[model samples]
Target: MAKASRESGTPPVERAARASLHPVPDGRAPASAEAWALIDSARQSYIDALPIAAAVLTEQDGDLVVGASNRRYDSLDAARPASQPMPIIESPTIVRRLLEFFARPGDELRFEWRYGDQVSGRHFHACISPLAQVPGGNGRCLLTLVDRTTEIESTRSLRAELLHDSLTGLPNRTAFAEAVDEVMASNDGARHAVLLIDLSRFSRINESLGGVAGDEVIITVARRLISTLRAGDILARVGGDEFGILLRLANGPDDAPAAARRIQSVLSTPFRLARFEVGIECAIGVALVGEEQTSGEELVRNAQFSLKRAKSTGRVEIHHPGEAACARYKLDLETELRRAIDQGDLRLAYQPIVDLAANRLTGFEALARWTHATRGVIDPGEFIPVAEEAGLIVPLGRWAVDSALATLAKWDALAGSAVPLTMNVNVSAIQLARDDVPGVIAAALATHGIAGSRLTIELTESAIVQDPERTTKALQALKALDVKVAMDDFGTGYSSLSYLRRLPIDSLKIDRSFVSGMLQDRDKVAIVRAVLSLADALGKTTTAEGVETIELSQTLAALGCSHGQGYFYAAPLTADAARDYWQSQL
Candidate 1:
């Protein structure tokens, strides 16, 4: 047989191919001459059809002989002549290296190699695999060349889409959630930290700047978070204007607070969006993952709860799931609350709302009291919100209304005369939201044989503001039937002036916070004055609550606040005690 032609130089592409076709120990017999010829012919055909250069090599005595070459391969290797034999020993140093790789005994090897000194480019992922056995003693290797630059570029594009936010090109929620899950699964028992970030007053930004600017703010926030986080940490947008972060492999609980402080530092900077420079502070809730026995869902929930607690306490950040006390206290309270409402353990204590000018009892505000069969006289503050959260407020409100009406009827029959008495009952938001509230009130009034005017309904600022349009319509139906509407706990919320003007309110009760501080604080006095002025402007009356001391009562009267109710007049009394107290006063 003619000596196989040796290309003078092996390019990086050819070298990579030779490396992939390391000798294998399959122990199969070598192909016969006729079969070898057919295989070489097929290899030639495959090389010819390829878009890039290709070649085949045979290892003989630690030297590579070029068995075949495509037209592109011949063009790239200018030292080679078609159908001419060249000695491998006379070729360049790179050809020697290619021959050495094929002579080695192994299955495969892969590596990246570069070519062309001036216009050099990096080609990745050259692989080698055994093609067939050698003719006499050992198996021969078949090598093929591939240019992986295009495939690598395509892979880069896909990775960008998979890991980044489409709008801002920042790492997205998917990447963030995966990072958190991984960190939580780590074997290191050290605490991990999760930061729950919520934009304070973002609704105002959305409303004022429109959604486009709002999106820009979100993008800006994403960038800020990226800059704030370490390499292993992750940040994601969980809700509108809400972001979550996970810090992996944290040192301890001490590390979490430091991380939170660092995040705060970044967020406190001003952001310029659509020509408006707005500063945002993140309400951060930090929860230690390993210590809390937390899963992904539990960690997020605890962080959110901590964030709420932080915001309520006027802090920028808070670490929560801190102790089991908070969650346990809440659960215990919820259980007691449900039991109290269901088992008739809840009671109503009637506080006399005196007409200060006449010293006569007009009506009573039915204050909620929980006489826990075990815990005695639980404060309304302790259980009222629990009831609301448990969705028991509707039933509880109905009970209070019905009981107050019945008490009014009983006192009337015992005193042997109908004292022009109006019973004031507090209503919750859920109660007002119910479509049956009006009918419930009417039925209670009819059952007591009392006119609608004898029932004065008190609603907190939140109840009316929850859904003002629907609540106003409901209140209008109640007003049409001559039921008096009073906005209770006034001057403690937003839109108080708007509420008094829009709703068909008969009176406004100044919140005790403002009344109690009125004697010493000018701002409290000013708030009370402003409320009274607003009520007067709307042609509504005012009641001052928390008139505990004589000084507070005298000061409230001096401020032109007429109706007063508190321990100064009489502490909340039982129905029978209220009847006797009213009789004594009369």
Candidate 2:
């Protein structure tokens, strides 16, 4: 029991036994055999070992006296203490320094230091408490050495992995978020800027050369950016090809663009990769943190909004109140459009397409319309682009097609085959990109029992040219179903007569710009003539849009335009007016 207590640990009863060199008197010993046996079976553990490098040092004199120590004390510093009763200071210089911490009356002090390279992987933390008061009232102290090298190293490694980009050694998005919040919360009344540098067409490097070369380009960009920025600026790789920079203590909001311009100027130079000279373009969005932008998320969101504009215009965009309002309006329109769609608040306006040669109605192009009870009518020019960007164009386009088909079926029912008219529905590029467009159109036609020949699908030349293979395939499938396809806004897109020859298009609609300008501009007149002649040669029908006067209508008819659609025929009318128009025309 005594051997166990002596070897167990350092505690009050064990510490009391080491108070004096001599044994305690018999009367002072506990009255039980268990207690006497504890002291009689073994020597005090404290005096058994010297105190320099123990897990705990009980007491020390100016001369380095005895104390309780674990088995570590003997092997520490790789030196054993003297067998004679002597101070540890007489043993080694390192031992003397360890005992010196508790020599004076002071609070506990923590120490971390290393010895020579002999204990390379080990770190010693010395916790020294001077003149510790024990139950026996001895003038003792405690000193402990703990090894925590692995723990500290692991913590540091984890932090670095979480906060830094491995390849570039730049701070990652996590670090950027924290920095943005800290800067926003600082409230130092100094403007800070966040610029998102997005590399345009950066994938060309990987596609043209390889991914390794792409990595080289990324590193080169990182180095160029770091060199271009001021010392206090921060640069981080927040995305694969996007770099985020935080400019602290900007002089004004203009400082953001000025800093971005400097970095952009540096990046404008071509990067010389292995066996390739690659040029790069960057779209920079600069957002200044202020009262409205209160967080990293808001800052990045505003910057992203600016980036979209920068990508289009190929210039730097500073986030302003106007752009913020525009972004908010787009979001508002998206919500309202979704509601309009779900509630069937959307309607179609029909603009009459006239057969000038026959002097009668040929078809009507269905235009989608939306009117908010509070805000009045929303223009298709505004909402259509917004819809496309939001990926809502496909759904809205399908609905418009379905509703128009059903309306056309009703019109045919009312007409009773007297002059059965074709109805045209415009399709966006996003709609045609889907493989299900043919299926959707077929379903709508079958649901209404409308002939595909009486339904013309008018699409912008640009939309068809975007993805020629997929679009051409979709168009061919429609043609297989006996649907007629017309290239709307023909001259505005980059497609040539050769491209038109490759597709199974039935007609070309001359863009309104040319039709509206042909009377004034000779080039417009020439473009009109050329489109008409080309259509006649290709055995395709021609439709002249934006005909506003009788004279212009006569000129287009003489120039071989088979159909015309504009204000001259009739403005776009509501569904009720359209139903009344077919009745009146009869």
Candidate 3:
């Protein structure tokens, strides 16, 4: 009857009834033809729909023997065809382990496994599930292989974009900061350091060369930085012209300085950018992270502060915060500057400007001085900029003009000679732009009973170059009052020649930098000589400032310079001292 059931494709119940009728004591039962057909149809459908390769393996002494494989599995290895047995040793380590575990005889178990291809280096994820057995049948393991290479590569690319600079493909600030945080969190015994690098004069380069050239310069800097960094050190671009570096597992503070020096050496080399050779200099600041628990943000801030200090002091690198005390002191001084001005603690010192050919004092240049209550005499370099930024310069400059006029009046009275006393007052661009400047000068001259010709207003090249047309009208108004006008710090700005030709000026004062350079560089000397000739041709007087030595003074005299003012003649003096010096000279 069972043989008849198998031949006729009877159902499982019908096959069992037939087997019972045979009454086999061993309980050997045959699967019905109907059940066998259903199993084959389900397996074929699953294999056809699955995108990944599917396979079945039998357990044998912790090894897998291939029982069945779909077309996809066979295609994965053309050397092995479906139903062809392959030893576990032929597969990768991960695959072999997965097969060994999944093939164990027990209830169904499932797990995820990864495999790497030896030939293509491609990675795949496999989901392994133990197959359910019929009442008395052997178990098998079902494996599904899914290719994960594309997904993995896409993930890696996204991470790279987040962690790296888009322009130079270097790590960015966020990534570098995270790395530092991780290292510090690990509490590594070795010392670590952060180096902050800021490009010097980058703004000037950007303004002069444009953004394209600037980008080239940045790329060159990145390449040089990469070359300079040692193993385990990471570099990142933090700002427009700022870079940060993290040196992991450093030896100590000594290691930081040496590393910083190497970076500086690399940066000092000239970079060739699009037909222009640009010499780049960087100010470096290094901070060490030792056993001290520090936040990454705090460390970065410290390094940045130190870098600013390095720039302000013109130092190559500064490691400690103490080096920045000068900047802090300047800040404090600035805070007190307004009070100084309000309290009349600020005073003007006059330096006698001598006529070179006549060998006589022609006028006085009014220099602002600050006498701090506690710090004694504060240098103008310390407080003048503060006053300017605080909007105190308007009042300060007016006071300077009034004070100088008063001093000139007093000097004339004491000397008992009209002497045609001229007082030169430095005027900032902001002051010149004020509509009341001409009125102020007129009022000052009227108050002091000094002739307008005896009062010279010194305007820096920057003042006129900033707005030539407007400055010209302002100067013309002052000149209408017969006040002498002199262009100060000449040859240090754009359009010096053009301004000289166009603007109404009574004198030209060469910048001190040019005057100092003229002593050593012949080109500078030639420039000075040419300026003097131009001034002569234009009927304009020339004053050479920063004549600190007798040689410089003599050189200016030989070059036909008309006026000179510098430490060589005399340091700026108090009003009384200047009056006394003029009397003695007379």
Alpha carbon lDDT of each predicted model: 0.73, 0.77, 0.75
State every prediction's TM-score relative to the real structure.
Answer: 0.58, 0.71, 0.49
**Positional deviation of residue 154's Cα in model 2 after best superposition, in angstroms:** 5.1
Expressed as tens digits, the lDDT of each residue in 198-310 for candidate 2 is 99889887898888998998999999999877766889999999999988644676678788888889888999987667888899988877668756788878888888789
- Tell me which of candidates 2 and 3 scores higher on TM-score: 2
Which pairs of residues clash in candidate 2, taking residues 3 or more apart in a chain or in different chains?
A: none
Error of 2 at 511 (Å): 2.7
Query: Which stretches of model 1 miss by more than 4 angstroms?
Result: 1-187, 197-244, 249-284, 289-301, 307-316, 321-324, 434-436, 496-498, 517-537, 551-559
Over 4 Å off in model 2, which ranges?
Answer: 1-157, 187-189, 248-255, 268-273, 415-419, 517-526
Please report how far candidate 3 places residue 444 from its true position, in Å.
2.9
Ranking by lDDT: 2, 3, 1
Clashes of 3: 0
